[model samples]
Target: MAFHYPNGTPYNNHEAPKSKKQVKKQKSIQFGKRGMDFEEEINKSNAYYLSRNTAVIHKKPTPVQIVKVDYPSRSAAVIKEAYFRQASTTDYNGVYNGFYLDFEAKETKNKTSFPFKNFHQHQIDHIRQCLAQKGICFVLLWFSSLNRCFFFSGEALVTYWAEQETTGKKSLPLAIIEKNGIEIQIGIAPRIPYLDAVEQYIQSKKGVAMNDN
Candidate 1:
């Protein structure tokens, strides 16, 4: 069988099908070999949530400065040059269950720890501000090498981030994260059922506050 693009171009299918061993080898090297990046998975999960009327979340678009454009035809124009004007604050944000949900999705290849360098100071500051406003802010971290994911609180992450300068610690240890963060189980429908973790986190915070009182 042959596949063709919508434009009537025949899709190339000359390569031989991969064997089981070959597929396994690739998966070992590339985590799941699911063909979609971590961010894409999160986007699909968000779409799924939206479709079910569960939550409304969306990825923030990066601001780019267009420098040049080429109009090859009357109906189409091509962007010839563009540059990013500034750094983005976070990846995803929206209102979920009357709470302002904001978060950044990130993946790491490291098996032992997630490096602090993966995050920027501006992002930390932005999340901190949101947290101060009592917004539900956190990060979805995918530990690719271990095929594990966790929902880390923005408050805890920022607190560790501040310690990085004085303590000289470079990374967040996996053990520490496993203990403090909420582990998210991978699933088919939602992909990463992070909202479940969010709910759990909210309950835990409430419990702690009540204990303090």
Candidate 2:
């Protein structure tokens, strides 16, 4: 089955094919040996949390409108084409420790910076709305090359996102993220142990300095 965007264009999870230079750059980056992709790691972590009654989190499912279906067999129906009902707002959202949690997960092979292109305007707007409601908002940024990840708050993201025009900076430097974001250590059962960062974030909001690590 082929999925399409609402604009009538084919829906592709990956960007267009990389150029020779891009491929060379990718080949040079040493990604973490961790068995799963960033998003998958997060999903497994969520499941772990759910099983332990630690927090309730899940990835928001993309709404698709099935266009054509064919019964290849009497018991099997195969969708031939579909279209997204609407663009996604953000990657994941849920309730954790009695506070609403919403975030996007992004990964980069670049060793020094994270490009602003990973975000879309709609996602920014959605985050802004969540902020208006005082909901907990942040992003999980995975630096594949360094095997590092950080919890970057939504407020900080908005601040840097706006500086694009004023400061002429297109990407968020790793130094800035390191300074402001909470670093999460990779683990086995919960591959991405992010709730620790979330707890720290909650503490910061209350003006209470505490580190559970």
Candidate 3:
């Protein structure tokens, strides 16, 4: 069976088609002041947390099925054929302050709204299961163009995603996220301090619970 991406798009197993025009345009792109990429920043932050014994979050390794391997040398083997097994759960999961933390990190160029397509049904289901076990589940969304980040609860994302099943809203509006999500400030050295956002989210939830009582 042909492999399919999460969106049902057939996997382009073949090497990406070469485009001479695209290559030329990419070569002409300008370079300027640069910073660590979003994912890298998050990785460094995770490292920092681990170093301090604050958290033990780590990115999950891609699950792959190896089909063929070549024994090139006594201590070397080359994986010739392999394929990813299936969609993955959220990235970066660990125990933090006695709480199970699980989250997916995503970055988008669009400054207005966050497209729901970034998330998959399997991931949503995983988050739901985690929540059922009393784990802290969320998504870390980065608006790169605007240099803004938000920690959105898995519960909120699930609610909106379910609404799409009936309301036909494909994307989450920026305004709603601004109100419901916890904004995270980007920093140097470690970069995205998402746990800070998580702390704020926890506080807000506690505040709501207190108000309800």
Candidate 4:
């Protein structure tokens, strides 16, 4: 069953993007492939990977600066005052196959384009910096309405984000993503299975060399 917000917008803690107001709409999906929310799936997939020692990717802790703390009865400490320290680099980062992997996960219900508003300027700059250090950077884009997921490289996202003013493209079209990104299949055990998509992407970039004699 799909989880819906108070206003009737379907959102699951697992796959739903962190947005204040969700688009009040629903998209239909056929049988057999239906499953839980996107974020939930990704979290489960990460757990699967961690259990198998396949990767060490973890969601970055929220940056918070504790200003005041109250110790009540020597058993509980209550946070009286706190503030966000700063914007974080990305959602997830870790070491996989000797390569540093960093990425952000996001979801959108827009059927036309993936909005740039979903990403912060700081994140774009961070991806660029990670690319400079040879890190495997990407974004897990979940199209909730279409029930599709894409692993798009940071280079593509950065290039397009930079050209927004020149091209006047406020969002990335599905066509562009189809050409450049790798589509991932959602499954039960792991959910998002984005790492599988990442492996495919890495192999595609490596060409036939890894397969040849």
Candidate 5:
């Protein structure tokens, strides 16, 4: 018997119903044998930042309500049943250079555009709230198919999201993203060197403020 989701649909332990070895092989092929996921790369990057005392960012743990628990042994306890209690705000948050940082990391297989459905209203609202406090809010978007990554500003994303309601745009085109977002070069040590992009964004903001003044 296979495990079924709350919706009654059987969960495919693998993305496709493939054998364990086959799934492993496929993942190696997909990630060029490195087998690193976007979140994993970001985690590595965060760890690198922390090691040098540059920044302290961590992934926010999802809140879950444990409905049942099983104590198989004195030292081992397994969660028999659990459910998400509420929606999460974002993936990572921390402080760097006396600035509060908040961001969500997401990836898409789409080559031409990133679907707006990937983002939730609550996450958008949370970003807006952070921006109100002058926190550095942004999103790290990974285009897996294109092998590209970008640092997109929270304000621009919020603006585009608001326009979607009236414009009826279903996705953000790659061209628009290229125009507005900073491209992040994938690296080996830190994997996704996103802090460089953050620094650039901060400088750009300062330039705009100087011009305004």
Candidate 6:
């Protein structure tokens, strides 16, 4: 089975090179293979929000082009190869309290920083488009090792993303995230109760608007 990009180029998702310290720590904890699905938790949270009629968010589906398939006994089919229809933008998106919400979810084991290599150029371009339209765009970053999450606003993310080349920073530090993003506590009903953070973002936007006037 093989996968290709939309341009018919071979595609492979590879892990970024790790330092000796990271390798040593990884061997000790094996956190990479912990088998915890961060997106699954977000899906559960979305379900909870839907149940309460609070928001209508769904994970964005990636279109795949099936190249080869085998029909066995006319009962089932096996896909042999596929290609992505196009580069994806964001993860979850929907409407909440009359505001259009678009966001990405990410989980990292690094306690000190979130690697920028995890992101693609297409995603940043998409986020910029959404923000230009005044959309409520942000990212839900889960620090798996610490069991902590943060609501990293798209504006803040883009600012740092654009400065990467000049600043020579390969990752976004947790200290900066702590200063610009909203920390969210794990909860029961809505496991990642992110709307509260959205509310805060909205209020802050309003305050800025008022100040501008």
- Top candidate on lDDT is 5
Against the true structure, candidate 1 reaches a TM-score of 0.81
Which structure is stronger by lDDT: 4 or 6?
6
- By lDDT: ranked, best first: 5, 1, 2, 6, 4, 3
Taking all chains together, the TM-score of candidate 2 against the true structure is 0.78
lDDT of each: 0.80, 0.79, 0.75, 0.76, 0.81, 0.79
**Tens digits of lDDT, candidate 4, 1-213:** 344445665532234443322222211222223444555466667878888899987776656689999998688989999875556598788988898999988777777678887788889999999999989899988887788889999989999998995887778998989899999887776777788878987887678556674
Clashes of each: 0, 0, 0, 5, 0, 0
Clashing pairs in 4: 14-39, 14-40, 15-38, 15-39, 15-40
Per-residue accuracy of model 5 over 5-123 as CA lDDT, tens digit each: 25554632212233435433322212322344676578778888988899988876655689999999989999999875555587689999998999988777788998887788888
Which should have the higher lDDT, number 3 or number 4? 4
Minimal lDDT window, size 10, model 6: 9-18
Candidate 2 clashing pairs?
none
In angstroms, the error of model 3 at 47 is 0.7
Give the alpha carbon lDDT tens digit for every residue of 1-213 in model 2. 222225554522223333335333432222245534576578878988988999988876655699999998999998899865545578688898799999998877778998887778888899999999999999999988788999999999998998985987879999999999999999897889999999999889877433433
User: Which regions of candidate 2 deviate over 4 angstroms?
Assistant: 1-35, 71-77, 84-86, 208-213
- For model 3, the stretches where C-alpha displacement exceeds 4 angstroms are 1-36, 210-213
